[model samples]
Target chain A: AQSVTQPDARVTVSEGASLQLRCKYSYSGTPYLFWYVQYPRQGLQLLLKYYSGDPVVQGVNGFEAEFSKSNSSFHLRKASVHWSDSAVYFCVLSAQGTGSKLSFGKGAKLTVSP
Target chain B: GPKVLQIPSHQIIDMGQMVTLNCDPVSNHLYFYWYKQILGQQMEFLVNFYNGKVMEKSKLFKDQFSVERPDGSYFTLKIQPTALEDSAVYFCASSPWDWGDTQYFGPGTRLLVL
Candidate 1:
């Protein structure tokens, strides 16, 4: 059973502050990892994805994530968060040969206070 | 930029009523998927369709739930005789291919079954 775990259910940060959202996954093999952001009343937008090669992947809006094989984790980070960055972030896992069925984590709601 | 679109942003229906959620996937996408997310919960994979057949379905996909993409038209998820537990935001996604391809998601359809 492939699954993703987002430890932080909610996070509050001041504008211009750095942000890090933790995500861990349980999968027997190397899985495709993705970070998706859902804005209020909007569809999910892919932030980034990691399948292999580079551990650190860049995403839209200056967001990035590092895939740690040893930790079984893919953590999203931003050097500075703007108010527009306030959204729900989801860590998703998709195993190979499974038709790309995604397993999502309980999203972390980010609130960037100005 | 390619994007997916969903019809009926929100729907309120009584239990035992039937509901059909429509998804207009990307123009060239070949794989379509459905996911369900209950309030404050992680999104769960419902089913994946390719080549006019279901490729995979998670355990959460009940017997009453069905998916089809008739005539290369909108990918649809139909739930017959819905139950209270069936209430959730249903998301539609599509990918060009299956091997770690990026899946573009549509704005979810929020379903409330009373």
Candidate 2:
């Protein structure tokens, strides 16, 4: 069975600091990866996704993710963070021919400190 | 921007009761999904419905669970004889066409079973 793992349950960083959220996936074939952010009392917002081609994919809010096939990892990164960036981040995986069903990680709660 | 709406943001019910969770997916979307998230736990995929039929369902989708989109109305997830274990947050999502495409998620409906 394909699965996604986000090792960190929570991460705290000061505003303007660099941020990285690690995500590792287990699948036998090429996997579709995505990063989604959920604000308090709000639905999830897509941050970025990786299907093919470029290993580094840029997304909204200055967020980007790097997909490494050898590592089976797609880590999200931002050069600088803002307080508004504090939210729960989920890493999702979809295998080929799954018909839109996504496997989500436990999620990493990021808190931007002042 | 597309959005998905879920009615009854919160619901409190007793065990063995029937609960219906309503979801209004993006108007142009063709695929709908349901996910369950227990407090402090990872969100788990429940089922996906497309073109008025179930496309795929996960192991978490219990026999008590059913989904329907009647007359192109709100997509609904019904839990018959709801169990205590069913107390969780349910999120509804939809995608435009392909299963590997991005999905828009709802704010989620929190169900409390006592």
Candidate 3:
């Protein structure tokens, strides 16, 4: 079965500092990766996605993720984060032949202190 | 951007009772999905429905859980004889025909079973 691991349960960063959230997946075949962010009292929003093509994929609000097939990892990165960026980040994985269902990681709670 | 809307932001019910959560998926979306998220935990896939039938379901989708969308109405997930373990937030998502594309998520319905 395909699964995701976020590793970090919580990460605190000072405002205007860079951030990198690590994600690792266990899948036999090629995997489609996604990064989603959820704000307080709101629905989850797509930050970015990586299926094929260039390793680096850009997303909304200055968010981006790089897909590494060799490492089986797709980590999200932001050069600088603001207080508004504080939220829960989730790494998701999807593969062929599973009805396009997505498996999500345990999620990382990001807190940006001002 | 498309939006998915879930009704009854929060629901409280006793164990052994039935509860129905409604989700209004994005217009023209063909795939509908349900995900469950326990408090402070990651969101997990429960089921995915398309063309009035279930395409896939995870092991977490117990026999007590069922999903349907009648007459092009809201996609509904009914949990009969709910348990304390079923107390969690249920989120609905939808995507266009492109199975590998992004799925828009709803705000989620918080269910508490006592």
Point to the candidate with the largest TM-score: 2
List iRMS for all predictions: 1.0, 0.9, 1.3
lDDT of 2 by residue, B1-114 (tens): 688999999999999999999999999889899999999998989999989999889889999999999999999999998999999999999998765799999999999999
Candidate 2 lDDT, tens digit per residue, A1-114?
899999999999999999999999999899889999999988998998999999999999999999999999999999999999999999999899787879999999999999
Candidate 1: CAPRI quality band: high
Q: Rank the candidates by DockQ, best first.
A: 2, 1, 3
CA shift of B34, model 1, Å: 0.5
C-alpha lDDT (0 to 100) for residue B73 of candidate 1: 91
Which lDDT tens digits does candidate 1 get at residues A1-112?
7889999999999999999999999998999999999988888989999999989999999999999999999999999999999999999999877768888999999999
At residue A107, give the lDDT of candidate 2: 98
Error of 2 at A58 (Å): 0.4
Please list, in the order the candidates appear, how each scores on TM-score for chain B only: 0.98, 0.98, 0.97
As for TM-score, the candidate ahead, 1 or 2, is 2
- Model 1 chain B: which ten-residue window has the lowest total lDDT? B98-107
Q: Report the CA-based lDDT of candidate 1 relative to the real structure.
A: 0.93
* Candidate 1: count of backbone clashes, pairs at least 3 residues apart or interchain: 0
Clashing residue pairs in candidate 1, if any? none
lDDT of 3 by residue, B56-100 (tens): 898999999999999999999999989999999999999996457
